[model samples]
Target: MLRNGQILFLCALALLTLGVLMVTSAGMQIDQASAEQPILVDGGLSPIAIMSGRTGMYAALAIGVMGAMAFVPQRLVERAIKPRPGRFYLMLGVGAAALLGLLLLVYLPGIAREKNFSSRWIEIPAPVFGTLSIQPSEIVKWSMLGLLAWCAVSAGDRLRLFWRGLVPMLIVLGLVCAVIMKEDLGTAVLIGAVGVIVLLAAGAKVWHIGVLAPAATPKPVVDRLNAAINKLLALPDVKTKLDRIGVVPMPETPAEFNKRIQE
Candidate 1:
């Protein structure tokens, strides 16, 4: 019988397989439509077909990666965490520099690509045909998590100390979130929350995480959030849904929202 982890992995792989099938099925109509167009006939495959193929290929790659990480020798991973002269520093330096470079690339003109009024992706040349747009923030989030774990492990018992341990970790976290927040506030907040949780799990004090609450939602941010929510609620589809449900539509004042939530 498969163990819990094995079962979970199988379930995730199944879901990924299902997603690939669905994408390909949806693309088939586009492929058929392209088949009828004489101009597009010379282009080989339709754009949707190409995208679906790429999605399946990526899903396969992801499964392989997950399997490798899951079944790799534990001792090998342990060896990475084991302390050696300049080893930890070298790892930290490389990870930090790569993350910062990717983040900075999102701000450079002609390199950063904007979509939906947000400049948060960078285009990298693909092996074939077109460029692939990637959100650096996604990669940085995982790197930051691994970096935090490395720092905590490297710190050893020093991680228990407020100055020697928590301060430096907080500093690193602050810098990462600061850079990411300029274009992706949502991702920055998510990274910050995860970093704090990891720190707490690694033995940092509770108040250290609590102190971040005030800064989590500043007045201007709350106002902007409210405005955005109001705008979204005013959209045609959203208004129709609200009307069908017979619930009062949004754009409520603070007091009205609070009252509604309480009830």
Candidate 2:
């Protein structure tokens, strides 16, 4: 059996491969200006390439970033939320400050680069990567997610408290969202939604945000819903019989396994 971590890694690698393929394929174009030129002359780039072109650079960068993350020191991550006695809890502030500073970079003089009618990127002239346009909002969105997880873990018993745990998280979440919302409303809302989910997972009560139980459905509406469900179950589709006990035999796996075992 594959370990959970290995399974997750395999799934992520597959997704990354698919994304690179799609992105590179999107760059395909025809020479409409030339009558002699063929359509999609070179076909397209492969799923993985190393700094061959724009898409190649993106693929390489993606692999490099993922590899860097995968190889991060376990102790460094542990020390972020847990430290020995008498040691300073510096990672929390450093992390928050770093994220905040990155967010603020979008407004910096000569560094700010605008896209989609908003100043959300900072263009840095990288050596091999040409002009590397860094979107601070994107960085902040991903980085702060891990930051939120660390905060939630470190909070422990305090994570359940309104003022000490949830409030602080909400404040940080609000601040990040408020910043990103100015540049990109969609990303801000996404960050807010995911942040709220993390907080909730960390044991923040739904009532902490003033949520109440939904009112009971009307009897007529409930009856209609039940009827619809029953009708769905009565359909001729294979999934329809899920309401009743049924076996779905997937024989391919067993066949392959048996063949391998015999071989």
Candidate 3:
């Protein structure tokens, strides 16, 4: 039988697989709709075909990353970060610089617009590379996790202190969340959640975690709520929700209903 952790990992893997399949299906539909008639006639594939190829490439990359993590000497990882604390800081600095560069690229001229919004994507002249994009928020998530973990471990027994251990984490997490909130609220919430998990794992006091409860509750839930609100506000069904919320009554006249719907 698999251990509990292994079972949980497998379950997560299954969910990820299902999500990938759904994404691929959606991509295929989008590709089919956008394909050129000549390509369809000649049996050439569309964007989905290209995406499928890229998915394979990404899978290989994921495998390679996992292999490297698995085979990397534990002693080396420890020595690299532990013995030379400067190395950890260097890695953190490099990651932060990369994230800043990505953020700046989002505002740079000649970058292709995504959905009429500024998103950080490296634009190459070639058509095939035009769509290549990277979200700095994702890197921020991992960086925060790594930095928090390092802080916790490096603090050693001092991590037991509420101030010495938790304050720094709270500060770092706050800064990261602020940066992420500029363009990506969802990622900010996710990174904060992971940071909290790492803190709890690092032997944080229950009360310390409890102290964060009120603050934590809003981050993830509020982001989702805001997104849903924005979507609803953009839709014709918003009046229905408003009526449900006791803001207004349902209109009786067709014209009035249509007018309210347009609001």
Best by lDDT: 1
Q: After superposing candidate 1, which stretches have Cα over 4 Å from the reference? A: 1-9, 21-52, 66-74, 81-93, 209-263
Residue 238, model 2, lDDT: 29
RMSD of 2: 14.8
lDDT of 1 at 156: 69
Give lDDT tens digits, candidate 1, residues 55-148: 7667877898998899788899888667643454555567677788888898788779988888889888778535777898999989899888
Order the candidate numbers by TM-score, best to worst.
2, 1, 3
Better of 1 and 2 by TM-score: 2
Tell me model 2's lDDT, rounded to 2 decimals.
Answer: 0.66
lDDT of 3 by residue, 172-260 (tens): 57676667666765555556656767877888754454222233465667556555544634444545444443443222333333354
- In model 2, what is the error at residue 232, expressed in angstroms? 36
lDDT: the better of candidates 1 and 3? 1
Kindly give the stretch of ten consecutive residues in candidate 1 with the minimal lDDT sum: 206-215
Please tell me which model should have the higher TM-score, number 2 or number 3: 2
- Candidate 3 residue runs with Cα over 4 Å from true position: 1-22, 30-52, 67-74, 81-105, 108-131, 206-263
